[model samples]
Structures are given as structure tokens and as C-alpha cells.
Target: MPSSDKTPFSRRALLAGAAGLAATSVGVASWQQLRQPKARVLQARCDSYDANLVGILLEGMAAFPAMLAKARGGHVVLKPNLVEVHPDRPINTDPRFIAAAAAAFLEVGAARVTVAEGAGHTRDAEFLLERTGLDELLRPMGVPFVDLNLDEAVDVRPPANLTRLGKLPVARTVMSADLLVSMPKLKTHHWAGVTLSMKNLFGTVPGHVFGWPKNPLHWAGIPNSITDLWSAIRPSFAIVDGIVGMEGDGPIMGTAVPMGVLLMGEDLPALDAQATRLMKLRPEGVEYLRQALELGATVSKHRIELLGDVITPRPFDVIESFHRLRA
Candidate 1:
């Protein structure tokens, strides 16, 4: 685990440099151009966790050659949703799926892949990892796991400070990654409607700075914080674990709904919009997603080009407060 220097990097400078590198290496004018008019969102039917996820993921990645080219020889950091461990509830992203994602990225030429997360519900990352089976699954593969909660912190201002919080303290592991891939579980959040890739970024904020459960961001506002975080971090891509999702009063305390599908795209907002639709909920009902559109995030259904398996929309049960979110 190499450490990131204490020096802060501006969001604009970091994104500009990344965009330039991508354009030079892949012959794309910019990430914006590559995703404009319509962003390609791949949906694959992964019937079970037993399925060959790596091959399915590779096939999905093949659809976006330029994205793969950009990832070649780069260090990739996978940020998965890991709130806590529950015996019966599906509260976290499945470790097997994370392993499969790491394998897929390596197959596509990523120099290295590291799994990192700052558990909001618990500071016991070692216990959480052991209980969730991530340690056992990833250690054998030599994939290092970083507890962002304890990692060195760096203060970076978001391009758009939607939350009005001046500088956000982020973990060094996240800031130094050549590519950041958000791997969120497809679950309903009691506060945010659906907790997809954008909301999953809550784990990136160091608990050491923000306190357990990252209360400051939540108090500032979940939706605004989500938007601000995305603006600052600009994750390179998102791969949603929808094979098994939680519905009804979630992010915790929900029933599992086996969606049996995986969704992927560079446009996080759009990808989340599509996932919202898959949950048979209205994307507009998700506040941050709506804000993302108002702030120029693309990928409306009219603008999203779907690739791979065609999945029929399934209705997910939401709590009383979120009934309006149902399509």
C-alpha cells in the first residue's frame, strides 16, 4: 500500500489530466464526447452468484473498448458498499461479486486492483470483512484491502460544493487510484430512495474526519452531499451488484430481492437512473439523480443505449414514505 502525499489536487486539474490522458491514449476527444448524446449502459443477466461473473463482466467491458484502453496499465480501486454484517439481511455488496469484478478488471489489463471502503455502521473493518467473507475471498487472490476509515486523509474541494461544506476530507487510497470504480449494492435507502453508485460514495469520506456513520455529510444533506462528492471524485466507472438486492426500508433492515442482473456504465447518474427504472421506481423521485440532471449529467432513457441482456423490469417493495417512487 503506497501512501498519497499530503498535497491536495484540485478536482478540475485531476479530471482535466485524466481526460487528456484518456483522449491521447484512446483517441477520444474527451470523456464527455464519449458519453454524449447517449451513454452506453450494459445490462447483463447474471442468474446467480454461481454464474461466471468474470466472463460476463469481461463481455460487458468489451462493449466499451475505449474505457478498457484507459484502464490498461492503471491502478484500479474498487469501492464497494459495506455498511455492516448482518446474519439475515443483505446489507452489503457480496464479496464474491467484488472478487469477480477485480478479476475482470485485471483481465482487461489493469495494473492492479485494490478493494477499499470506510464502513459507516462499524469501525470494526476487520470483523466486517471476516463476517462478510471478503478477507477470505480476496486475500487468496492477493488483492489488498484498505480501510479508508483509517487511511491518511486529504482535503479536496468539490467542483460544485452542493452541500456548502468547504473542503471534504477524502481518503488517500481513493485520491491516488488511476481509476475509481464504485461497486454499490442495488438497495433502497430509507433516506435517499435508492442507494446506488453515487450514494455509495459516502464510504469514501474518512470516518476519522467525519465521524462514525459519516454524520456530517448526512446532516449537511444526503442528496447534496452525493452530488458534491461525485463532482469532487468523478469516479471513472460504476458496476452495480444487482444480482441480489434489498428492498423496503433499506441500506439496512430490508428483504432481499434477487434481481439477477449487473449494470455498468461510465455515466454514474445515468447508470443509476437505469437501475432505478429496473427497480420499477421513478428516477426523478431520487433527489440527487434529479439534481445530477439539472447539473448537466446525461443518460436519460431516451439517451441511454442499452447493451447485452434485456431484463424485464421488476417491482421492488418500498416503505410507505417511498411509495411515490414506485413506477
Candidate 2:
């Protein structure tokens, strides 16, 4: 991974240089330094999940002042991962995390907050919402519940410079949202490597256009598809739920390890970088983050400020499918 203290490169120059390097070698470290991203990251450690909801909500809110500030009176859309069907599984975003965020938005005087998601693994966004306790939590708040699955479809063309991706399925409501707050669980993915803020957007893309009914977008490729989706609809604020993270074969089928941390960011790459550190993995070692860096995402720690509790994240007991780092 590139040192956080390394000299900063302008966006244009970084892309040009990275393009040349990627064409020649694309070493994990070189690819790790994305020029700069538009997102800012803040992290906090919640010692216990048993704290009062109001207090917890405030703490969570503090990490994302920019998001709340921007969403003062407008409609805010909250997207949580509902890729799988098990709520107790703890492999996806926790209901408490989503509920706390919703409550905070209201407490801060936001006009309306809508929690939305499109389930990729099941036709049960509604079920996932209920079982996960998000539906019950948001209903009384009088905020709307949106299933992106039921939303109208919009076609997305691949960017000219990119390859591997062809087209995508996008949700009309999500695309038009005034503010997007990402609530993703911290998990290791068999395909994408690490599933963080960028990978959370997978639920926003419709299956119809991206080959869900016929072809699963997973065929488009893991990290590549991840970056493409991020480029399409980057979230304004990202709040990662790492309370009980999944390790070793996740997004599903992993053992839950308690990390008790929540990460907030506007920059997806930086968030991923921090999450990588928490997982005891090198941010530059992850393929997608490096790819995002090359594509102009922010991976520089100097560009971000860390707020709240600071501690070293322990590496996962056993490395999984990721590339081994060069020490």
C-alpha cells in the first residue's frame, strides 16, 4: 500500500500516471493511490450496542455532519444492504444501525427520510425489510418505505473508457434521490474481495437491465462491476455497519466477528481503505480499491480526517482469498 505521507498527485496527473503504470505493471501499491475522491471519512467505535438509541444516534450523526447539513430540509434516501434474506445472520447491515440513522435524520430536522433497497439474492426486499426490523423501525417515523425492485427501470450505457461492463440496471428513484446515505455491512466477499460502500450500491441496480432476470450482473465481473456502479450513483454519505462483521466467505456464509465499529464517509475509496485496515487487510492489496484509485477515487489518508476513538484493527485470524501483501 502507498504510504499516507507520500506526495499528493493532481487528479489529471494521477490518472495519466496510473494508466501508464496499470498498463505496464499495476502493482498493488501503485494502484492503491487514487488521485482523490469527493468523499470524506469519519470513524467511531461503539463499545456497546446496548446504549440508548438517542445517544447512539447522535454519535452516529456526528460522523456525518456534512451529509446531514446537506440534507437539512430535503428528502433523504437511505440505502442498506439487503442482498441476502437472513436478518439474524449479521452478514448485512444491522437494523439498529439503520434505525439509529433514520432517527438521527429526523432529530436533526430533515423533512423526510426514505429507506430504500433492491434485493439482489431474493425477490423479497419487503421481507428482508421486515425481518431485518427496518420496516417496523421506519414505519412509525412516518417516512416512506421504498423497494427499488418496484421502481421503474432506466438503462445505463458503459462509460467510453471502460471495458468489461456493457450496460446496467438502475433504479429511477435512487437516481433522482436528493441525498443518498449508504448503510453497508462490513463483510468479505468471495467475488469482489471486500464489500463496503461501493459494493452496497449493487442493490440499487435493477436486475432487469443488468441481466438479473436472465443474466446476473455478477457475470460482468466483481470489482469492475463494483466501480462501475459507484461511478454511476456514488452515495453522498456512507455509514458502514461493522458491529459484527462477517469474515471468511461472506456477504454470506462467514463467521461473525465482533468489531463494534461504524465508519462514515463521502469518499467510498477512503471508507474502503479504512475498512480494509479494520479487517487487518491492506487497502492497497484489495483489487477493487486499487481499481477505483486508478479511476480517480480518493485513497489518500492525508485527504481525510479521522474522528472519534482510534485503535489498531486486528487482522482476520486467517487470510482468505485476497492477494498476500509484500511487506
Candidate 3:
């Protein structure tokens, strides 16, 4: 069922309640198992989207046999960053990359592969898909696209409840997926420091319940809301599109940087941390990453194991205020 509460909840009330419950609600120790000394992250260098992306993705996916085994005969949902459509800017994940990912998963024996996104910026999903060329690429492949913004919702109490919203109304399609894949475009953000895998989960928050652009989450707090969402959704894997990334004042309105790489891993935090470093930024300077580390998410280089290409660090431009995040 969809959320019945149409009115937005008060941010003050939610924060106050969360402050009281956080001590007991957040279980840091339970996430300890994920804090490995070396979490495997595959970093494949693909010069452009036109390259053999499917072959590269399949090779990377093969590295994690356990995840593939689990994906076998299971429903797989690809949550790509479909923020908005812009002709000149690299605002959304490249549609070619999304199609390649879908093809790779189907080849690996996924019972079903669905492309899903609850775009925060726009309500017209069809127009976004059409404009971004995603509809054209996905249609011939028989891959169904779910507009998560309009999907049925279920109230879920986040294990961490860091935002004190008590329960989040998550899209039913994402909640029921056998395996959820977060496919985010690597980018710098005006808020949240950097938007990577974990931040990409923001699309799962049904716009029907949270309103367009998810204002309630922003009102509560972007960082806290991100961590809380991670605790609730716990996506199965991540594939970050970094072949062409955004820099400076982003999420939108940034210039593109052709970093020429694709990152894949089961550990979202570790993968994001590695991506942050590749951008020549410090993950610890990012609030959500710091909070994630506190909750036992791995961010340190010593904790991540890299495979594939050895690309040199490239500094991505950022707004004046975010200068401190530069490494």
C-alpha cells in the first residue's frame, strides 16, 4: 500500500525524537562483520562508454562468485541514477552503461532484471527516460522499467533511525527485490560532499510519500537520512559509472571529467570510499562517510582490496566551501 500521510512530517519533531532513540536504536556492533581489513573492489578502466562494457562488467561480476550464485534465479533490480535529463551535461548515469549492466546480469542467470529509479528531481519518468535515451536502449532488450516514484510503498523502521522519522516509506519494488544493484554515476555534490553508491539509494525513497526531490529528507538531514536509508535498504551490490563523472557544484550543474573507469563491489561504503579517493577527495571529510564508518562501514584504504587498473588520482573541482574535502 502507498503511504497515506500526504503531509510532510515536521523536521524538528523528527530530529528531537531521533535524538532520544538513537542510543538504543542504532546497533553498531551488528555491522562489524562488514568491516573487513580488505574488502574486494574491482576497478576496471574503460576509456569510454562505447567500449565493450558488457564484457568488462561480466568479468568484474565473475570476481564475486558468491553474489552471482545468490543472483542466480532471483529477481534483480538495477537502480541507476536518473536524476534528470540534460543534453550537454553528464547529469545521469549513461544509458549505455545501464543496458550493459542489465545484459551482464541476464547472462549470469538472473531470473529477472528490472531497471528501477525514483527520480527525485522530476515526476515525469517517461519523459526523463525518453530524453535520456534509456527507453530506446532498454526496450529492445525486454527489460522492464519501474517508476519507483509511483510504486506501492511499505513503511519500514530503519534499524538505525538516525533521522528519527521512525519509519521510512520505501518503494515496494525495491523492498521486495531479491538483489538490488546500485548503479550511480560518480559525481561531486553541493550537499553530502560526494554522491556515490550509498547516496544513490536516495532514489528508493518514493516521491509519492516524500514529495519531489525528497524535501523531508533534506529537512531532517541529508547525512543522517543517507545512513538511515542504508541501514534499512542494505542494497546487495554497487557498480559506479566513472568513465565520465561530474565535478564542482554537482548532483547537477557540474562540468564533466573523463576519469575512464568503472568500479564494482559488494561493499557500498568501501566502493564509495575508493571512488572518493580516486577523485582526489578525502572520504573522512564527507559527513555521511564518517557516519558510515562510525556504524562500521569501511572507508580506509588499508581496508579495501583493489583489482584491475591502476589509474592515477585526478582532482575534481568543488565549490569554495567544499575545498577542505580535497586531498
lDDT of each: 0.90, 0.73, 0.91
**Higher-lDDT candidate among 1 and 3?**
3
- Positional deviation of residue 220's Cα in model 1 after best superposition, in angstroms: 0.5
For residues 91-203, what per-residue lDDT tens digits would candidate 1 score against the true structure?
89999999999999988889999999999999999999999999999998889999999999988897778888988999999999988999999999899999999999999
Put down candidate 3 lDDT per residue, 1-327, tens digits, no spaces. 457465466678778878867754554433443454458899999989999999999999999988898789999999999998888899899999999999999999999999999999999999999999999999999999999999899888877788989999899999999899999999999988899999998899999999998999998899999898987898889999999999998988999999999999998989999999999999879998888887777887877889988878899998888999999
Task: Please give the clash total of every predicted structure, in order.
Answer: 0, 4, 0
- TM-score for each predicted model, relative to the true structure: 0.88, 0.82, 0.89
Q: How many backbone clashes does candidate 2 have?
A: 4
Rate residue 77 of model 2 by lDDT: 86
> Which is superior by TM-score, 1 or 2?
1
Regions of candidate 1 where Cα sits further than 4 Å from its true position: 1-37
- Candidate 2: which stretches are off by over 4 Å? 1-34, 37-39, 63-65, 157-166, 211-216, 317-319, 323-327
lDDT of 2 at 68: 71
Better of 1 and 2 by lDDT: 1
